[model samples]
Target: MASIQLQGKIFIIGEIEAMTGLHIGGSAGELDIGGVDKPVIRNPLTREPYIPGSSLRGKMRSLLDRHLNKPLRRDRPQVRVHECNRLADYKECSVCQVFGIAPSRNMEDTMPTRLIVRDALLTAETRERFNEIDTDMLYTEVKTEVVIDRITSAATPRQNERVPAEATFGPLEMVHSLYTLDTGSEGSVDSEIALFDTVLMGMELIEDDYLGGSGSRGSGKIAFRKLKVIFKSRKHYENPQSVPIATLAEGDGVSALRKADYQSQISAAMQA
Candidate 1:
């Protein structure tokens, strides 16, 4: 076994507020639905709408893959993980370096993933006051949608559940570990900045791409706000410094949140 040194760790924490009705569909088992076909996922214990980290991470990876024009494997059902062995000489593959590759080819090669995205839960403040604002304890708003038959000009109505626009969910956390290679460079990608860039790129892409489902019909629009990046070192993990990053808030809405200086803030965190 080879020795791998721990370099540093960066933590990004923020809130995700729904701009429009957001619907990340959950299984509609045998539950009777009067007219609803799809339903948003809820925490089994609280029955509150929560965003799964897997959904966010997967969407970001796919978006980055498309943006970079990286060749994707057609054999797999989900997005393909890039191989560090496949790229050209001396070139760092951003996606693979950040997200990492699982062991394959008889478990011969493996790249440990660096990024960790935790499930986002509704903030306590919002959860408590949701009923005051929306008059629903479930924290979800029901949207009635109509599908018009183009040829017959007939309208068929269906009900969809969504997290209402302007609703906030939070403490969304993303932790990225930095490693120093044996050759003294920061992992195969050579710089932590590259990894941060990849993360921000995916985040920005999601703002345009939309999350969950029914994006074309204007569902799942969201924005990240109050982003704070913190750095921790093994020697002084107890006393970590918060990186002075700019807030994503530009105005009172989602559009303002999208124009955040994510990269610049990350750069400051890296230096700190």
Candidate 2:
């Protein structure tokens, strides 16, 4: 920690807009007749549905792990994830470098986690719009789905509470910190692009894939919009400021990121 230098931070700012009904289930109380079978998670204070940072990050991590085809730990059946606990494996693995491994191993031997995803709350304007419309819940809607029994041809119906389509969550912010090891070797998504690309790839994967639960059933399809990337260095922190580097529109994220070597650009900016 003493020898390594933190060059700067790259902030990825954007909005997560639901293209279809989104459902991330909350607590299930005692089964009550006429109550929602599955309810979207909500902020206890506001009673408004929100996208938790953990959910977003976990989905991204899982998607990225799949993208890289990283190996799962068969040794621990309980914890099924790509862990970079080994010092040798960690040095070459950017997936775990960006999304941190569990601290089951020695902290001193491993690199610091690079990414941080903040909670994305329902936008105020979207909330206002939903208030005017006649949603079933405070800021959500309940849709009843029926399941059919092929054998008997009997139907069972259940209600699912979800954030209605066209709802927007923002201002979603993801921070990617830059740390240089005392030794020259560092894990990279590519030699030129480095760790920044992995974050962009995760975002793209989520957009093409889905955010929350029940993706195949068309519950959580989302798009990233109004993206802005900013750079802040140690000196910038001392001055309490950041520099805006780029702003992107919907469907222009990962491709735009891959077009340039953002790692080199940001590192140069950090040093400057």
Per-residue lDDT tens digits for candidate 2, residues 1-272, read 54665666778887889999999888777323337888788887887899998899999998998899999875476778877767788878888888887776775656678899999999998999998998888778888888999999899998898899999999998998877656334342224237777888888899899988778888899988777777776567666545434332233455565566565565566445
lDDT values, one for every candidate? 0.69, 0.77
Candidate 1 segments exceeding 4 Å error: 30-35, 76-91, 105-110, 133-137, 183-190, 238-272
Highest TM-score scorer: 2
lDDT of 1 by residue, 1-272 (tens): 44566555667778888888889987777334433567788888877789999999988988887788777664478646544455341145778767776555323323357899999988887777776774432687777789999999899988787888887878888887766555344334246544665776787788777889889998988888777666554433534444333332234333444455644554444456
Q: After superposition, how far is residue 17 of candidate 1 from its true place, in Å?
A: 1.0
User: Using Cα atoms with residue i matched to residue i, what is each candidate's TM-score against the true structure?
Assistant: 0.78, 0.87
Candidate of highest lDDT: 2
lDDT agreement of model 2 with the native: 0.77
